[model samples]
Target: MQRRKYLKGMATAAGIVTVSSTGNAQVWDSDELSKGEEPKNPSPPRKGDSVMGLTDQIDTVNVGIIGLGNRGFSMTQLIDAMAPDKGVIKAICDIREKPVEEMSDWIKEEGKNDPPATYSGSKNSWRKLVQRDDLDLVFVFTPHQAHTPMAEYAMKKGKHVAVEVPAATTIQECWTLVDTAEKTQKQCVMLENVCYFDIEMWVLNMVRQGVFGDKLTYASGGYIHNLVAEYFFEAYWKDWRSKNHRKYKGDLYPTHGLGPIAFYMGINRGDRLEYIASQESPETQLTERAKELPEDHWAHGADDWANGDTTRSEILTEQDRQIHLQFDVKTNRGYSRKNELAGVDAYHEGFPSQLAVDSEGHGFVDDATYDQYYEEYRHPLWVQMEEIAEEYGGHGGGDFLEIYRLFDAFNDGRPPDMDVYDAAAWSAVRPLSATSIEYGGIPVKFPDFTRGDWQNKRKLQVMDFDTI
Candidate 1:
């Protein structure tokens, strides 16, 4: 099937219009909107081709996962669910004993005969896991600080590494991972979950098909739901939150909001991140609330730290594209995580939440007004996501697709959807954004992690659905 045919019936209010085909750029009307459900088409070649092709070329690429925390466990579950035809999980490691034991038991209980060998001990146990010659790829899911060291170790050991978000905590570490990957000729991918979201993938498909005209500018959005009190009170990583709360406070988690935008904008591949400036709200209600807790409470000491407020980071690309990224743990007592994207050329399409591309020639507005308009113009990805959620079922089904792609890449010897440079560019934003906060909201230049050859990088591989 042609790429453009997949975008049929994608329209939304607020002038968020998407091109219908490669040759014909038509604004889809409300009548084109999918109502009940959309049919599942064949898999795209770029999506599954590389991995499928590589499976026969290479033998099994043994996988190892480090840091079996919440995210780590989720990743392991997804890997287990992959059709055995792809790859197998060979090892698992974590400092926390409980998760390691639990994951091992779960693997055994499920009768997955190829269950990964479990490793757990002191914080330094990660080195042992990376040194294993039996492993082909290692997934680093530890905290922000450990991303660099673990990645470096894995790369040097001739193992491909897939680190969790914020690939590195500092600029130096960022370069270390990139340089090591280049030196070792091994892949190091930052597992930015948002990049694999079905909605994001669909939008990428639209962009590849030129459904959105020469993309002008796009915006990335994020909102912190500080509903989890544990983040502030729990003694996580030597109580790091309470200890350094004041030192590094802005945009603590920027990858989820920035990853999709970077991929869609071709950051590193076509466009480069020029600079970033972040502004944080002076008052932190959440921090103040933590202070009021009794001294006996686990996080009572956290109150003595920094205030809990909102911070917004605006990054500009070399191509002059602007990405408005907002991060906040303070909310008016509610649950919310908002991610939105805006483009000058194409209409809007979003799922798992409301999104619309204005087709009436009207401009964009705030979420409230956008929602009012979205009721009129809606994209088919909304309904499609529900079915996707059911089948894949990780991080709204995006997780499963990501793992599937990873295993396929190993099998086919093709680069992943989000490659080494893509990982560095997106994950590096966290520390780079933090620098702005350190400098009192000043604009900071984002390092070209690719050492300035980002523009000449290979074009992203697209999954050819017809061949599948």
Candidate 2:
């Protein structure tokens, strides 16, 4: 594959060029991928990068999982269904006893292996589980607050870490994971399943192949799912998604929207986030809903619903690319990811499915043409693994695919596709957006979790991860 260059001038200064127009959308592109000039490749493996990619080759990975909430149970079920041959659940930890027992029993019921030691009954019980030496990989599916600390501790204990998204809730924690992963050489990957989503990865394959002209300029997405019912349901917990409405603001969960776009744009690989500015919609929707609740209801109380009903953040990269992110959890509207990608002569947009200009700047493609595109551009990894992935299940089999690749990478003596730098970078969006939101949409710079190494060394190597 050819080394790609940064679209610094193109992304920053290129004006929109109108090629031709369809019904509602315009035929416009800024820079085509193949038209860009090549830049020199950065040195391979910068300092402190020895531990950044793949771990030392290992045999079967032994697993210890923490948290048995919604995501936790799903992961447990995934392992139960798919990972028996590749790894063992050596230990399990969850604050909730019921799910833990259920998982332990499920593992045993399947007769895959011996039932693992289980931990519950206390908040600190996970620490004990982490201390065990038998665990080769510690999976953290706990609440948002525990992600960083648990991952840090597990890496220190000589275990690779696979935690749920936003690997850290704070910038300092992002730094902690970065520094820790460098010292430990134990992999820390945020299980961002969206990166493996069917449609997303299809677009990623096209982007990587430079199908859409390489001088990439803009990308946008959203986490706009209506959660009114989930928020007001009687069983809602403070630690989960429900109560977060009344707490912090600014895209609380950003990795889903950011992950795929960043990959397509080579963020943290060649480009870096320069600064961020965010603005939030009013918190009126949640408050209006609270009006109908009884006085004793949690929503009727004085909790601080600091988060806006919707937030849109504009982020600029050092390479001059632009990213527009949206967050709208409080609305009554259905879920949508307003995913859009644009370059010199090709672009895409969404309300439902996207209408994209073909790679050769031919014309706009509508939803009716999606099947042919899917047939042509589906990621090769998905082509090979989607069958088994669908059987194991998760966000359109993304969960199974990611887990499969993790194990495959380990057995193959290579790093899994996602590393600690990617984890921390994607995870930091929430807290960073929070800081930017609080100060009236001021420009806040994101930390370089890879230090300065991202400038030269970190290129996306998808072919290395091209197996199940």
Candidate 3:
């Protein structure tokens, strides 16, 4: 693929152009557009308005999901169950042939005669899938490194793309993905499953409704895990987690922790990310253990590739709010997926082992508060999520919800809840935080992925499944 000279003004191609309004005039460029022109009729408002009074688009979006690995396969199944009536999986691609065949077989077993066409080969095979005229959206589920390139190619090919978490691994890649999405005028959603979790959504609603009252001095976002036993170390692809282990030694996978917090805190929305300073534990357990093992062992003699056990990034939002973001992939101790939000009036917490919300005077309480809360504010569409989970379950019903929203956005012609800017903001933390680590844990400024207009942009369209 020829790397086009980076254009300064807006990019235009194939009648699909990104126009940015600086001052009172609109400037345009065509370097990124497939054909150096703007689409004659760029996505217009849908015709028939729905009960939610949202857009009236009803096109059946044809999807092609690339990199059918574990997450991709789960997303495919979720899409199959969630939006069967709204969209169809037209194609699936992966570097490995086994996953493609497995997904095809699964589709057939589900009684769908016209299973999505399967393609496998090099990393670039994704380009072919995205370019297909039949595909409206492309899901890139490959490793972190491949995300930006695939998304760039997909958007240029006139296909919307939804990539897995940690959208890009470098600051440059993050800006490129965001820039290309805007340049191509195509949707680029980051599939952050945790954002769609039931508990997280409930908390968001509560926060929005002022149930949390003025959030102040919050401690949220943490990842406590022992992933050394995972197949990531032994995979045939030599997963980037194993390959580039040394380079990204701090908060390498911060999205899992940062996603929900950013949403709740309104980062890039009501609040903007300012700067973050990170600190990693001096030594890693994996490195010490690896040194004790024989040289031939999978992890042995790989001390140079080991990252610190714990990385804590302190983020300061433009709102003057503080966030304690923690990412750890070492140790088999306590299992925790932290999502604790502290506020002036109230607080909510969610670790993998438990969930809790507290008011200042109330002190520690039981889980019944959350249960009652869920019962009261639960969206009617949420029940459908359970049904979909029964049909295809993964990641505690999160995988299904992610795909459900993807298809829902496509059919409704609205930006997804986690759109391009959201993807860039959430995932960019990985690289920015890494930069902080490289600079002796100094503060790193997060580049605004939206280039400063995300605030004026409409709130992402959350699927209103109530009427469906």
Best by TM-score: 2
lDDT of 1 by residue, 358-407 (tens): 55656544588655544432223333345654575887777776776676
Residue range 362-459, candidate 2, lDDT tens digits: 66786568777778888888888788889888887989888877877777777688888888778777877876676556555566666675776564
lDDT of 3: 0.66
- How much is 83 displaced in model 3, in angstroms? 5.6
Native-referenced Cα lDDT, model 1: 0.63
Clashes in model 3: which pairs?
12-29, 12-30, 13-33, 13-36, 14-35, 14-36, 15-37, 15-38, 15-39, 16-39
Which of the predicted structures, 2 or 3, would earn the higher TM-score when compared with the native? Answer: 2
**Candidate 3 Cα misplacement greater than 4 A, ranges:** 1-58, 231-233, 292-295, 352-360, 367-370, 457-460, 463-468
Better of 1 and 2 by lDDT: 2
**Residue ranges of candidate 1 with Cα displaced over 4 Å:** 1-57, 233-246, 304-308, 333-338, 347-389, 462-468
List where candidate 2 sits over 4 angstroms from the true fold.
1-50, 301-303, 358-363, 366-369, 457-459, 465-468
| TM-score of model 3 vs. true structure | 0.82
> What lDDT score belongs to each candidate, Candidate 1 first?
0.63, 0.75, 0.66
Question: How close is every model to the real structure, measured as TM-score?
Answer: 0.77, 0.86, 0.82
